[model samples]
Target: MGAVSAPPLFSRDFVDDPYPAYAWLREHAPVHKTRLPNGVEAYLVTRYDDVRSVLADPRLSKNAATSFPGWRPGRTGIPGEHRSGIAAHLLNLDPPDHTRLRRLVSKAFTPRRVADFEPRVIETADRLLDAFGPEPVDLIRAYAFPLPVIVICEMLGVPPEDQPIFHEWANGMADRSGPRGGVGRSVKRVRGYLKELIHKKRLTLPADPVNDDLLSALIRASDHGEHLTEDEAAAMAFILLFAGFETTVNLIGNGTLALLTHPEQLAKLQADAGLLDAAVEELLRFDGPVEFGTWRFTTEPITVGGAAIPAGEPVLAVLAAADRDPARFTDPDTLDLSRNEGGNLALGHGIHFCLGAPLARLEGRVAFERLFARFPDLALAVAPDELRWHSGLIMRGLHELPVRTSSPIRADYQAH
Candidate 1:
């Protein structure tokens, strides 16, 4: 047998199916440095242990402001993050600041709160699924995308009518292949809307505002001397909405695809609703929405997977690759709903772990349960090879999932 050749990185083909290349990197060069699409040179860590260590490593800082000079934000950093005043969120800050900010919003996403939001999630999922008839429809547009957007909007106290606006802006920004100028415009629009929304909320807030929604809680915190500024509030809101929905959108989309393609797994899940929670975890580990962890910079010299990295250089831990690492997972490529293994870096690991994870999981479980229950005959409208994936580095998701409730699912289809 010959060694596998290095797969092209960030090309259209690679975007559609990046696992082969990731597998090669894991085997051949676990910590390899290469130029990213944005033209920044960074170390790509592909092993499971290395990714976890790198993510939790204080030497690999998350604060982008201190990155080496001449390094542009490109797709890695949010557009107009500083000028538009949305740069103070969790993704960009290191500790103390990160700790303080996370504390303020932590109450909204606690396990108890997320569990309490279950009824709303089920109602929202059912409402969205009801719109789909027997005819073929793009599930991504009709179901997967809007469910999370609407849920996040509810959590943030945004009016129901404003959700469509959020859907448009969020869709625009997630399209990294779209015109750069267009993405910037979408970012500006979101920032402006958030700033105004914060101002409007502040005026109507009661003497002791109830913490029903996250934004209201943030405003109350700011007013009560938590030192959270107006910009910080807007920044936090922007991050929560943007990060919160996109992940669940992909989770529902990707997990559905996983189930639909893997008939045995699908049947196992269908036969037993009790397996829903474990299935969600397996789905996340099998093909998670997060492809790579957010950009991290080497705060000081460090060694990762035998590769010595210098200070002030960019680094990316391939989350999907790490989750698929053979060293950590048995038959890593196979999707087993009953797989009892843990330690998937899908939401993330350590202090920087995704704050919205509990919400995302609850949403994923409810979304899948409702989706299959509503349309047991649901099957792919197109062949697996014909599907297209989003060409973004940070997240993994399908562009569209055409499905039909009228036709019986094909049993012999190969899993993607």
Candidate 2:
């Protein structure tokens, strides 16, 4: 059989409803060549097995610095000078460096550690919901976006007052369709803010660093030994601030939208709250936050799903596509709350798996539990087709999720 020809991978049609095209690629061109929105030639690994394999393959290097000259990795258009700091994040590093960077903050995000945030997560969710009036509200702005941002901010010791600043910076960086200058400026602002924040935290280092938050711990790590450089520390903070909340924001937004559209599953979850865990997993598998894994470059010629990709070419594992692969899940399109097939790549696979997965899950569970419990008749304010999704190749999130809280609460309830 010959390779399947499809629309540009980053086309609006593909962004709006990529499943049909993904299905075609999976069956006919699993290891397909396509152009990124920036006009960079790349190969997309679309099938479940291949995507899982490519994610863990050492030959597919994450460090674009090692790629052949003239082949730049996919970026948000941040300039090289400003990029060096934030780009030092774990997502852009290969083994050793990647391993080192991940280990520094991994303990803070452990299952037990993340579970510790349950009380705060619930409080934040409820507080946000309480503030919502009876009328229709953009759930993305009112709840999904702020909840995770606040939680992550609290966890990292970022001032609650500065959340608006972080949100502005993050939005600019995440806008892949925006001008390069704008994205570059956002990156610079965030990097500068992190540097100042880290410096301030270091000056006030608590008596026992171990008792401090993730940022303080990172500062201690850099202060004590060669574990992390100043640049790397700031980069780590920037990535955590942006990547941490951004993905969860989408998970909550996308997952909630999914439940709203699938009333049966929503009803099932609302009835038996115990199914929250499985439901969150199924929702992630069905249509999770990340659309594709971060950019990777082939260090050597590699063949995936029968297609040979040359060395130095960029590669991406379409997690959104792989999770819905018919070969992997039964009735892949159906939203099954009890789905136990497991191994969904929504949070990704292998060593570079999302460090924030535990937090994301906790947030999702808390968000859904509080959301449905507070407003049993929660629903979309507009038609399903009227919703707009973010136009980015890496992240899959709704721009705004307008929803109506059917029941009105007393005005005093808003005093939280």
Candidate 3:
């Protein structure tokens, strides 16, 4: 049979529900190559093993800025001053440098440290639920969003009181508009706020000690603790805010929604509480928080999947669909929490695996446990289809989730 010579395999219909498009590609165009609306050609890597190998391949460097010509301008979402601002982080760095920088910060995010943060994470989660009273509320606004914002704020040595401002900056940056446009207004606010916050922290550092948190550590890492460039400091702070808050927001929101829609499984979870960990893992795998892995641009003529994608192209791996590929699992579509932990690409794989994996998992499990325990009769206050998803681009999240608690008070309503 001849190769399918179609246009982009995915259209509006596909983005709306990419599974069928992914299934089609997996069966017929596994190594699909196509151009973007912006005139960029990309090699879309599907299939579990192929995706894994491609991400792990050293041949495909991470520093797309220089290797892939002119790749920088459009990709960052926020352009201009903040373009360079965001570009400085480790996400864009590859190999020895990526290794070094990640190693320095990696100590703070270790499993034991995450466990230590559990009390704080749970406290943040509980306080958020507390705000909703005993009434059903929009879970995103009440629980998922604020909980992470507070925890990340504290982690970075920023005051919890500034959460609203921090959230504005993150939403600005994540919205993918240019810094001068959608994000800049918020970036400006975050930059401005961080500048003042940084100034205060410098005069009187937190009581948690120099090794207490990520911000102080990064500040000290710079030349003699005096050479951290203003932009560098602001950028790291910005990166921490966005990375620390957004992923968990979606995981909790999407994971909760998945449970509500799949009542039998929800019932099972309520019954066995032990399945909480597995359920969170499966939610990550089954529907997963992220729709696609962060975009990667090819530097050289990289032949991936089955096609020879030319150099300087943008490749996006649809993590959500790839997780459900039959090639990798049995009954991939079903949200079976009992499935083995290995059945997921949710945290991603290889070196690019999320640096904040431990924290995200900790927040997720803790958030679910407290939410369910607080409002045992928690349920959807609106129709499932009526719930709006924060548009499909860089992130996937619910605009709101209203829930109702059957009782005004519970025996164990203590904030963690």
lDDT: which candidate is best?
1
lDDT of 1 by residue, 39-144 (tens): 7777889999999998899887787777655465554676667656677789999888898888876744567867777898898887777677767999998999
Ranking by lDDT: 1, 2, 3
lDDT for model 2, please: 0.81
The TM-score, computed over Cα atoms with residue i paired to residue i, of candidate 2 is 0.93
Deviating ranges (above 4 Å) for candidate 1: 1-5, 73-75, 222-224, 407-416
For residues 1-416, what per-residue lDDT tens digits would candidate 3 score against the true structure?
11665434436455445676677777777676666545666667778777776767666766666667766465533344343355565566777766766665564445676678888888777777766665568888778877887788888777657766676666565564343366655666776777676666665555545546666655555422334554555666666576667889889999998888898888888888899898889888876777767667676787776677777766777677678889888898888878874747876777888878888888999998888877767888888867766544446667777877776546566664
lDDT of each: 0.84, 0.81, 0.70
Give the runs in model 2 whose Cα sits over 4 Å from its true position.
1-4, 72-84, 175-180, 206-211, 222-225, 410-416
lDDT string for model 2 (1-416, tens) is 24345656667677778888888888887887776776666788899999999999999887777774445433422344234456778887888878777877664445776777789888889889888887899998889988988887788777878978887777786665577567677878878887888888777776545556777777666323555666777888877777788898899999999999999999999899889999999989999999999888889998888888889888989999999999899999999998899889999899989888888888998899888887889999999888888877788998889999767764454311
**TM-scores of the candidates in the order shown:** 0.93, 0.93, 0.87
> Residue 182 of candidate 1: its Cα lDDT?
74
Lowest lDDT 10-residue stretch of candidate 3: 76-85
User: Which of the numbered candidates is closest to the native, going by highest TM-score?
Assistant: 1
Higher-lDDT candidate of 2 and 3 = 2
Clash total of candidate 2: 0
Error of 2 at 316 (Å): 0.7
